[model samples]
Target: MPPGITTFAADAPTLSAANTGFMLICSALVMVMTPALAFFYGGMVRVKSTLNMLMMSFISLGIVTILWVLYGFSLAFGTDIGSFIGWSSDFAGLSGIGVTQLWDGYTIPVYVFAVFQLMFAVLTPALISGALADRVKFTSWALFITLWVTVVYFPVAHWVWGAGGWLYELGVIDFAGGTAVHINAGAAALGVILVIGKRVGFKKDPMRPHSLPLVMLGAGLLWFGWFGFNAGSWLGNDDGVGAVMFVNTQVATAAAMLAWLGYEKLRHGSFTTLGAASGAVAGLVAITPSGGAVSPLGAIAVGAIAGVLCAMAVGLKYRFGYDDSLDVVGVHLVGGVAGSLLVGLFATGGVQSDAKGLFYGGGLEQLGKQAVGVFAVLAYSLVVSAVLALILDKTIGMRVEEDDEVSGIDQVEHAETAYDFSGAGGGLSTRSTPPGPGTSPAPTNKKVDA
Candidate 1:
């Protein structure tokens, strides 16, 4: 919720019911994105581990919510401690803060702000799950995130958004969470995948998505919910900044989807639905940090560039051989970085702040600051996340048994499968459909796993 405007309690504006109500609704919208993400990642895996893929994201809702209530909020947004972290007894256990107390100088209640930011904290680690899909034990994955968020997510959030934090003070403009959420999650994904090694057959198997329709559905929901994610970061409707952000969000996403389709058609000779869905998400990520500062046209330029860049980046795994099953590294990390840097080029001197971009007479200074935020978050998350993954790997174990992984994580780990066919006319019947006239019976295309 860093709106590029930091305020103190002494300067606080009286609570406005309009702003309070808007933020509450925005919180709910942001909450839906986690389950939507579960569906998106779930549909990307083979049928055998579909439930596992889904649970990887669903578990974050439970873990992070409780953590945020405990000490997570305080560590993230409390009074700054030497510009490195934040702390205050009032925020610990979410105690002593009155329900009607305003947050900073905003027109919303402290509770409203905490809950809104809670959604962001919950979604950050969930983004990492896509990279660690089939092979890890569910218990280990859960534990990994518990540690990852504590060591990596909280500190980075403070650095980027918390008052008096280094990046915040340095004027690294992230309207939403390109650095704290996307880059942090993406870098953490890379770190863990490095320690855990490749999925059993990284290069040998196709591992295509099992359900394109489900993926599209999830992507649509994410697109709908992201309006809250980006626009709501302003924390109020007191100005046209949020309105411009909303318009930028829409145009950027449309431009990115079209750009991705064009690139996919040229490169692979087909405009696949997966490319469309992935491209939409790339645009969303790219615009999250910069949308408030750029015009709609600037947003389109940012999205188009990110669409092409991320589309090309998905192949880097093949060249270097890392098993990022859902292309988290390619889309989120690269997209986050792209959106962040583009800010320095597209930001106007009007919206959000008086800071102009490179194209608008601003120099390379802002770009350099953005690089610092991007690099700091990336390096810290990558190194610490790898260390945490290695510790878990050496201790109680992080990977499932080879037999269990090679089989199916769903039935082995959860004792459940994504589908139960005994009720569906006893699964699929081998009997052929009756022929029409003299035409031959149509074939049943049986789907296979990687």
Candidate 2:
């Protein structure tokens, strides 16, 4: 075992059944978020590209799960090599580990810990799919995420969570994955979008969400799952830290949703379901890193700030000319940065760890650390994602052809559609006939003419 990991004697009660059961449940909850993400992004895109959007998030579960077991887990949580990465083969194939052996500090089985972290590895890259919606090829996207998690995510995970990681050593206060997951994925989304270029008629065309109800459902699932994402990080249910994080998570998300609605009423002159969903997500992302450190009041401040800031930030793509199709950059990146930084200002050091923020008389020390963590992850992910996208664009191609894009990615790529309206009765249909040469496709907004 790596240093500081103590294996219990054969007779000792090595596992805490409560913590193990809790973590297992938490892992399952986090796993659901990816599909929920598919629904979330699926509802936001044009009707033609909905299934492709859902597929983007769904495929990650298949791809990352295999890779994580093979070597991804080893590279992420194995013995530290230089504070930048874990040993690539130490835990390869989960070798040399037994069932009774416990993970380093947690009382749960090692495999349990591995699976919990695997959920994170799976979701992080999937988060980027929202920004590249409607244009990317499924195979190329799969390839990109495979490479991205291997090169970008694994090392970063080590940096933030691995033993002797530089950021961990520096006392950067990322209780969960403010930097490793959200900022990393968000920056990567921006990078890939920059290289892949805009959708055919990004600003000119109307690309409103096809199903706000679906988006709301997805948002509800995400909110439900996030309790595990945040509180489960504590690894044990015995600690009061998990309870604090749970309460903070709830209040922060509620505050953020309200804050976003408030902002929308003022800026857009209307309250929108999309706004509420987006606001809740922003709050969830912001609180992921800081919930373990901040108070309920602090969580409100963080959520409110993230809601307003992300609300405004989503429009930056228009001004800057980047096609972040579903506003991943605005919500995840901005929210992650807001939460990570705010921890330095609001951390009370009483809930989980003994790290106080500036407002708690801790000065600017924690804030500076947070900034370094954020910038490092952002710069690294951006550059790496851009390079991967450019390479894919040069080779097998990153985007669909113009005709395929206009026709629909689902039809061209997956040979299917999300919704069909061509049945005899006024009910849903599964059959979708591809448009023939020189024939126009059906109007996306039209229901079956009953």
Candidate 3:
């Protein structure tokens, strides 16, 4: 018996078909988010490094999926082994688990729950890839994710979601994963970039995104998939909480997008498509933990603040000199911190949890708890990630060669290019020269238009 979990209901093991169907669909939606992330990060890098960026996100679906099925799930959700971690091998290989078995309090099959959570495990590490883009070796990036998730992510998941986990027991309200996913990944991004250093042309070069249209497409896919990410965290669709979360997610994201654009207009003297996309993601991060606890109006507030703050936060890398290529620390870390902390101010008792926030007369107690959870995860993830990065850097070499980086990670690492301009005369002029002395004329089969 886990310490904080109470057996209020009998172990009848009855399943709800509706909830099972809902979670299955949500799981698929969340699974798509990883590839969606690949596109998002892919289009944000220079043309040369696009495929490597996409692969960084794509590979996590493979690596984390295997780790999760084998023991990652068990280590995260297994019986409590103290509050910091779960029993590692208790459910290794998912052994001794029977079909038609229901999760303790939920109406869905335990397997359904496991698969749904697996999507989260997949996306979290991939989120850090954006910060380290354009400079890391493919093999080193793969190895880093495998180890980082094993050491940092699994234990944090336990502390936040596992029954006997300290933060769970302390009544900290993380409706989904603002703390676990966003802040954890964001801080880890900062830590690794610190250890691995910066790209060759860190501040001097103009590292503009090669494909803004692709970035928009990726952002759109992320928006579509995020509905599942937030609402599905409820674990069942039969409840009204899912509905509330769904609405809040939409409203917050919309508000954040607008707020981000407005801020950009003021600071940069014009609105930009990139600001809109980044703002949307900022809102998503902010509302992940608080959507279920706040009203539509509250959601708007959360989104608006995240939009403005993350817009500002993205500039910090330039100001502080750490080169977070994609602003992971700014958008995710800052937005996540904003959302988690605001839950202390705006949470209402009528929502998912009975905990109220400062504005609702709950005092500053919950706010303190939220801060504790935020900083604890931040500090732990930062230190551990930095240490892991240092170890990997020292031993197997974490970065690409300068020549490889200058040429492009795609050609050097994957031996494939994302776009082949070769068919288009290497992206140069399409015109052909007229027949001349001692010169072979262009193929007559191909017509040359004047």
After superposition, the stretches of candidate 1 with alpha carbons farther than 4 Å from their true spots are 3-11, 429-450
Model 3 CA deviation exceeding 4 Å by range = 1-13, 88-90, 424-450
As for lDDT, the candidate ahead, 2 or 3, is: 2
- Model 3 per-residue lDDT tens digits across residues 22-137: 99999999999999999998889998999999999999999999998888998888888888888745367877677887777777877888888999999999999999989999
For candidate 1, write residues 1-450 as lDDT tens digits. 552245665775888999999999999999999999989998899988899988988899999999988999888888889988888789988997998888866888889999999999999999999998889999999998788878788888899999878999999999999999999999999998999999888898778898999999999999999999988999999988988999999999998899999999999999999999999999999999999889888999999999999999999999998888899999999999999999999998789988778999999888889999999999999899999999999998889988898888999889999976546565654444576798766656575553
Tell me the spans in candidate 2 whose CA falls farther than 4 Å from its real position.
1-13, 88-90, 427-450
For every model shown, what is its TM-score relative to the native structure? 0.94, 0.93, 0.94
Clashes of each: 0, 0, 0
Q: Assess candidate 1 and give its TM-score to the true structure.
A: 0.94
Q: What is candidate 3's TM-score against the reference?
A: 0.94
- Give candidate 1's whole-model lDDT: 0.90
